[model samples]
Target: MRKKLLHIICLASMILLFSCSGDVTDELPALTRAQLSINLLNNGDVDQQEEINSIRFIVFGSTPGGVRLDVNEHILLSTPETATDIDAQLLKVTSSNDILVVVIANEPQSLTSKLDGIASHWTLQDMLYDISDILNSDGQIISTTGMPMIGVVRGISIAPDETQKVEMVIERAVARVDVFLEAIDGGAVTGYTAGSTSVTLHNLSHDSYFVMGNVGNGTRDNADSSKNYGKVKENVPEIDLLTDTWTAATSDTWAYSSATGAKNRRLLCSFYTAERIFKSDYSDRLAVSMAYVPKGPSDVTGITEKVIETITKVDDKGSPTAQPFTEIRRNNVYQITARVGKIGIQILTVTVEDWGDRQDIDLDMDL
Candidate 1:
């Protein structure tokens, strides 16, 4: 009888223990779901809007254990549909700590597969891209594929069953350069027109990372051929204007003729380049090559000249200065204003400003 009573007590103890275990399990938090509404702030410009062909949205969460991902989605815009805003459902959100949200726009199709490897383990800086894939053979961002852009939101608290509306500003990963030729006092040289001028960007890297940083030199594909400028005109002497004899700048392109006598500072050409930041040294920095005709007196035969001048910095008056210009940030516009002065003297102004804001950095080339 005593053994029977002891067995009954043992069974009772087992029942109570399981009941306590169930209570403890119930006290722990359960994974929940939330919703996210992403509103991409954009200008209504059609050209800018066309750059956004698709978008990839990702959410990452961290805990004492390890990293976790609640969402990974890529959406392609339909015909004539510019995705200015988006809505996504968040799954398996822990809500214990803040989460990180990343959005990338107009990435290559191959990136879709690469992103899968990063879903479980990733960092913001680990997201790198080869610049060649983003640029065309002419070293310009491909309009059909669209320009690359990114936006990140961190420390976002997503409560369970609550919809969070977030506003993000996405910026391009490339820089745009607009060239303007303005005819200043033609100096002693007569018939010197701003026409027959060509600009070339030199010392550019063939490959760079799309990710923004203080320095862009990282692992490159090494096969890229965009190291120099694009569509350079033939018969343009590569010799230095300061040291070599003068040659006339000539091009069959109609734009060359239209640039002449641009006293009103008409747009010459627009091109794009990868981002760059040079803190102290400017050797690896991008440089501009301006080739134009330096007109002499009409009566003087064989006095007309063409020369290529390379400039690295600009002064307050927009002339190339000895001081080094440091950086070329992404999504910024470098407006070059070339002012023709006396023969062999040209002043150039390089105005650096955000794409959204217009500023002047005039480059006056007085030749």
Candidate 2:
């Protein structure tokens, strides 16, 4: 009995397939979304409100050799006049193998609001493409070329007052590919230290390009040589007769100086903003040194023009140094010494704008 029923169904299908007189066939796929016309009833009426009454769809004939053909169908509707429609309608579809038939219906009584708002209306073709995975559940394969291929269509229109109908057809398949970001070579860096001595910073990132240094000193004095009036030879001022001095004048030098081989004494530093130092392409090692000072204030003002008219002194020719001491090179470290004067010892201090961890440096000198 089961075999007999299967035979009967097969005969009926064959008859249906050959019954068509014209080119149109039941086997042919439906039209694409772009080809159909979708209209909303009473489109601009405030009171009635627009909606979809029913949908009308048509399927076209297939190409030779069972190849699918491309068809255009219409998909959505909008108010059209209010604003230039910049909104784009997108539909995503997937299939196990190939789609065969697709059916769509309104979500039971789900209707659009009367007020102005974004509304999406899907046509028969649009619905089919959106659910291609379900249609092709059986894994039935169909020739895509020349035969109807799946695709989506979009349109803009206003809401109608009464129930509306959307018509569409399915056709040629549309393919979309995905895109992303790739990295390139980092950037260039020219480093420099403020005063002298090459400073090395670990884990330096690409962003740390500028460097600076700060150096300073301090001093203290404790000596009394007065009222002796040259009475004793031991109390006589050894260096200068007019100035009072202690017997240990030659033995103890009052000059203030940085401790020998002190790393903090001659600072080597570099600077960079937080943003640049943390960049992805920064290097772990940094070698920076000070470069010559460019056109400074003195260069702009024509001061210290030329002592001798014929020959131009290279060092002091164009401009005198702006600051008391300008950093000549990074490799050269300054050994600052403070001499004791009549009053007392003097302290020296230095600060650089963009340097490493330390902001400023201070040194004590015995004057």
Candidate 3:
């Protein structure tokens, strides 16, 4: 009887210990990480939208009102889906802390250094540091020859256990200038030949992160190919400018990125002569210049005079003001029409649009 009682008492003690352990385990909260769903956008612009193979994201933790993200720890995630999980330690936050993130897609693999390995948190200086490696072996800006369809989303807020949905509108970091040669009355251009005219946009900046419109050097309007300028050769599409009403700027395909489609020319943003005058020359501006003669019967000689026209900004009062013109903002379109006898080319208009369907980008067709 004594041995049996002792065994029962020992079993009772074991049950109490196990029950206490279960209670302690229940009291502790489960480990939770911040969940994020990243949705890439084409800014609703059909032209800028491309297929994203994958994306790289960096999450920085910052205390409320603090300028620097915690440099000691960070979360780096490369994902192929629109939604994924990020390490909690890199994004763990208290009530007053916020999260800052920078994401890029379709960028060059060599550009991995641009984010500095995603190991530590970033300071304002680190965040603003420019990547000098944006040049090729010949030192030409990489963005000019071939650029990644850069889509960046910055300054996001996240809380512990919060599932955040983000829209990262991605667009071409460049503007496409569609050059048109036609008669003043919207007739087919008879004199100029296709594949002959090389339009040049001069004095543009090549900085990697020059995201804003106003923060750059002044641009110059020039037509001379001998000087510094960006040129698009063999760019004019095959169209009967005289007969076909080629009024819309993007009526032709805009190959602004390399995303496995016919519209993936992936050129960098060049200096664009603005068609809108709403903002008084935001920063240093540039001009558009091209000189070409109409195709003649091989023997035609005295057509020595080339159409040389320079556009100057006319103010609200309609006067040509020479304050360095506006830098061509990225993802904009400058549609140009050069008439036979007109002194300066007529700007049908400059349009900033989102590429949606055929109708969305060509909304200016009515004008």
Candidate 4:
């Protein structure tokens, strides 16, 4: 009986040992390191002029963990789309492990040019809605005139057991106003020349006049002959000359002294003789030319000139009509140049504001 009992105990011990060994083997496979990988592929042909129609990135693994993605963290290594072109596309990340960046080419038949149409598509509607709480409380127009304001998704997810990749794109929009100043020369007269000119602006709603300058004339000096003076010296009473309010005077000593007069003649003679008048029926039609100035990072190296339009009259309501001018929409980056011109002798003010969205991340992932 004792021998039989010991044999049974030995058999039971062996069975228990085999069961424990099997359990260990099963757990060993689970202990292996999980792998993470990401792959990027472009789905279109190389010759396609359509900007990147679609971009995809995939993550795969045997034991996948739900991945957290940050679209702002992903780097674009190579793209068919230029920085300016990226702003017109729609970006979508379909699945947790799969990312799809899509861009729809603007129809060639649109009223606006393809590039302009693309730029206009970068509307921050969603972003604006998200920040409505703060914006609604404020009364000021958030002047994002020339600013590059990009939108970003802080976090998103892919599959339950895969690495996550982010999705992103550029948003661009442009509001352009063109100005033209045509120099019209009136016949020359003694002591003065008549120059009738007009200003024209395109796509502009409202404008104000700050200063005016004579073409090629140095700074305004009433006593200097080299400078160009409107018709005050030649007219009998040149008080209402340049515009409706401007006039010339020979007897009014104050007016003659204040008007452009020779220094020696001003001291020797008590009054100024009327020469000729530079007359304009529309004071609001004054325009000036300025060297292209870039206030932002966009490359506007080749831009040469910009037209400035001014507002002439105000009705009972404050709405204004933009003076007539030509419009210029070139393919190159627009910049604000330092060299500026004027329509008269007054100082002009220029306002620079944000223009578009500029947000991107440089992501360096080993995978």
Best-first order by TM-score: 1, 3, 4, 2
> lDDT tens string, model 4, 243-358?
21111122111111222442211110010011122223423222232221211222111121133333222233645344322221111111211221121111122222112221
Winner of 1 and 3 under lDDT: 1
lDDT of each: 0.46, 0.19, 0.32, 0.21
Global Cα lDDT for candidate 3:
0.32
TM-score for model 2?
0.12
Alpha-carbon runs more than 4 Å astray in model 1 = 1-29, 45-48, 83-96, 120-124, 161-163, 186-197, 211-263, 294-324, 342-345, 358-367
lDDT of 2 by residue, 1-367 (tens): 0000000000001000112224545332432222222221222324322122222111222233341322222333332211112122222111111211121111111111211121222122122122122112222211121112211222212121212222222211111101100111122111112332122212212111111111110000113321110110111122211111111111111122244642222111222211111122222112121122111211111111111011111232434222222111111221222211233222232222111112222333221
- Which segments of model 4 are wrong by more than 4 Å? 1-159, 167-172, 175-333, 338-367
Cα lDDT for residue 48, candidate 3: 32
Per-residue C-alpha lDDT of model 1 across residues 81-156, encoded as one tens digit per residue: 3544433323323463656656667876546677755655234344555556766655556656666665555555
Q: TM-score of the candidate numbered 1?
A: 0.63
Question: Cα deviation of 103 in candidate 1 (Å)?
Answer: 0.8
Please state every model's RMSD to the true fold in angstroms. 18.2, 37.3, 19.5, 30.4
Candidate maximizing lDDT:
1
Give the backbone clash total of model 2: 53
Mark the 10 consecutive residues where model 4 has the least summed lDDT: 1-10
